[model samples]
Target: MCELLGMSANVPTDICFSFTGLMQRGGRTGPHRDGWGIAFYEGKGVREFRDPDPSCDSEIARLVQNYPIKSRIVISHIRQANAGRVCLENTHPFMRELWGRYWTFAHNGQLPGIRSKTLEHYVPVGTTDSEHAFCWLLDQIRERFPKPPKRQTTLWRFIHQCCEQLRELGVYNMLLSDSRSLICYCSTKLYWVTRRAPFTTAKLKDADVTIDFRQETSLQDIVSVIATEPLTHDEEWQRIKTGELQVFKRGQPC
Candidate 1:
């Protein structure tokens, strides 16, 4: 299985603190050493960095750790390959254009017979069942709504239904976004934490590091982080229920 990390913020915020803890799990602190990738949304454009190497040892991962790329939405993954070879194409956080906007997806689990499900439009560029499931999901959305829907809740509910269908196939924990909304679904384990005004210091569980978010954020800022596991030892992380779907916009759950 892989690990997922996502962020939705009211204001553009860097995920360096949380990402630092997650990277440690790639090889140093955990066994997910197959590969890693991340996608950062800036307006209508998305910037992605991927490597077919353990995130803890990758120089690119170090650069991302050092650089503060502020974005309102971010999705990242660290893989422990189960269905695909350890290559760049098999890396998580796959990106594809949808409805005039880029949709980014990162999955943490597998579907053994997912490829048997026929797809209409989107196609996987890799062999991973994770990527195939993502393509099939987008195909379903495109089939249901040829154009973007007017009511956002309708789209959210439809996406949840699609996820529930996929969940029936196998473990389907995932994070998806279309540059505006962050969607998370949990089949087994997932957790989230939101930080806002009156922020306090947070200590990482994987690394001996602490950050005082008050010094880095404003009173009006709201930032929510979703991860496969709790990244911080000091902060209270809410566990998403099994088979539940969550939609977040501007750092608030919808």
Candidate 2:
């Protein structure tokens, strides 16, 4: 299985600290070393970086770790390659356009017989089952709503239903975003943490790094991070319940 990382912030925030821990797992501290990719949603646009090489040694991964690209929503994944070949096209954090907005998706587990599903609007550019499942999901969303819906909960509930159906197929831990809200669904393992005012210091589990968020953030900042496992050993991360779908907007679970 792969690993996932995502963030939703009330204000634009950088994910450098959490990403650093995840990068070390690509080849050094863990086993998900096939490839890695990340997407940052800045306003209506997204800044994406992908590498088909092991993140521990990839120059592009190093650049992303150093670059402080701030965004309100973000999604990332590190692959272990169970379905598709280890290549750029098969990387996670796949992007597509839907309802005039760029939507991003990253999957952590394998789904069998996903290719047998039909798609009407969206299609996969890669051979990965993750991408195929994404296309099918978007197609279901678009088919139900020819245009974006007025009430947000309607779409949210529909997404949860769709995810539950996918869960019936296999483990479907996923992180998806539309540059505004992040939808997280857990079929097995997923954990999250939220930081607010009077933040404290956190120590990374996979690297020799520590951050005093009190010095780096303000009293009004609210940031939430979700990962396959807790990135920091000091923080109290909450586990998402199995078969639960959580929608995060403006850094709060909605």
**Lowest lDDT 10-mer window, candidate 1?**
107-116
- lDDT, candidate 2, 47-73, per-residue tens: 999989999999999998999899899
Off by over 4 Å in 1: none
What value of lDDT does candidate 1 attain over all alpha carbons?
0.93
Per-residue lDDT for 90-184 in model 1, tens only? 99899998889999999988798898999889888889999899999999899999999999889889999988988998999999999989999
Task: Give the whole-model CA lDDT for all candidates, comma-separated.
Answer: 0.93, 0.93
Which regions of candidate 2 are displaced past 4 Å? Answer: none
Estimate TM-scores for all models: 0.99, 0.99
TM-score of structure candidate 1: 0.99
